[model samples]
Target: MKDDKQLEQTEKDKRQKAIIEMIQTGKYRRQSAIVDELINQDFTAVQGTVSRDMREMKIVEGKDGSSCITTEPLQDMHRNELQRLLRENHPPITKILLFTT
Candidate 1:
């Protein structure tokens, strides 16, 4: 049972990696296209599966009105938000060092 679960996770990882590569190419404009491509590659896929992958991967449409989907913008957004929260909530480095010492 454990081995089966590991195999399933490995397959999911491969599929998501393929999805990332396809999205990076900026050719697939929609989830259906991604699903079709995955099918062509002999991987079992459906709209729901692709949609979940996109959501989990933080994929979003390009900001320039293009059909391309990418994770770059979402990554930047998350990075900036994290920085802001850290700036607001984190203690000073000196304080941290003093506590550790």
Candidate 2:
């Protein structure tokens, strides 16, 4: 049921996720290395796509000057923050209202 554009975007997202995991492992230190790994994994991506994905994801150099993918995608970052806020703050307020107040 997915259209061509939708399928293309899905594939792009999958490739980006795999890149992030590889970067996190510190094994793919260079863009070419990442591309090679992706190819090995059967993902058809080129260096340019990988470069764009890194830039879009806000991947940056670490303190040691190594490529790092520490920033989560904006959607993921927002979701995580929302979950953290709810987990840390919401339950206590509910408990106070139901049991103490």
Candidate 3:
């Protein structure tokens, strides 16, 4: 993680990782929880922001197939120091470049 002051918003890699970890850990679920966590860190993360972050992080629905968060490995997910990539649509990859690590 870089200096918190250097980050202008939650799009940052560190922030993204934190969001991923939070979702995986079940600390971020309902809108209010995410908002409260962000507020504690002086960031105003709204419900929409949380949703966008989840999407960007490629936070996937669990194997149970209900709308839930899961760290279940993406069959095609690839992660490097730069990013985590996922195939958002059929034929494997199209239209979306999400990050998840």
Candidate 4:
């Protein structure tokens, strides 16, 4: 048996991989129902968190059908809220750099 931390990391990796595969196969759109099924199939994670994980995986909501991970959206900074994040959490770069220097 693995230690708790190792087990956690393994689970995280598995969850991430599963999420990616599902998104690629056009499965991420199914939502809570599928998540519930995964949970029953021994995925020791919550459905709510799985939904959040989809966001972290860069899965985009589509109009025609389900969500999928798109590298284009990931690369296109203009289409995302990244700028708002920068504006909201613009840390003191000078202070950080001063410590490093």
Which of 3 and 4 is the better model by TM-score? 4
- TM-score of structure candidate 1: 0.60
| RMSD list, candidates in order | 9.7, 8.4, 13.0, 9.9
Per-residue lDDT over 31-56 for candidate 4, one digit per residue giving the tens place of the 0 to 100 score: 77558656766887677778777677
For model 2, the superposed segments whose C-alpha errors exceed 4 Å read: 62-65, 74-101
Note the residue pairs that clash in candidate 2: none
Question: Among these predicted structures, which one has the highest TM-score?
Answer: 2
Clashes of 1: 0
Residue 31 lDDT in candidate 4:
71
Residue 59 lDDT in model 1? 71
- For each candidate, the alpha-carbon lDDT, in order, equals 0.72, 0.77, 0.53, 0.63
How do all models score by TM-score? 0.60, 0.68, 0.46, 0.55
Question: Which 10 residues in a row give candidate 1 its minimum summed lDDT?
Answer: 65-74
Question: Tens digits of per-residue lDDT for model 1 on 1-101?
Answer: 23787667657766877887787787887788889999999888999998887777677666663344455645654565576468568865763334553
Candidate 3 lDDT, tens digit per residue, 1-101? 53565345324444555555555566566556766777677665787876676676567655553234445323212252224332223244447878999
Instruction: Report how far off residue 15 is in candidate 4 (Å).
Output: 1.1
Clash number for each model: 0, 0, 0, 0
Better of 1 and 4 by lDDT: 1
Query: Which residue pairs clash within candidate 3?
Result: none
After superposition, which runs of candidate 3 have C-alpha atoms over 4 Å from their true positions?
1-11, 61-101
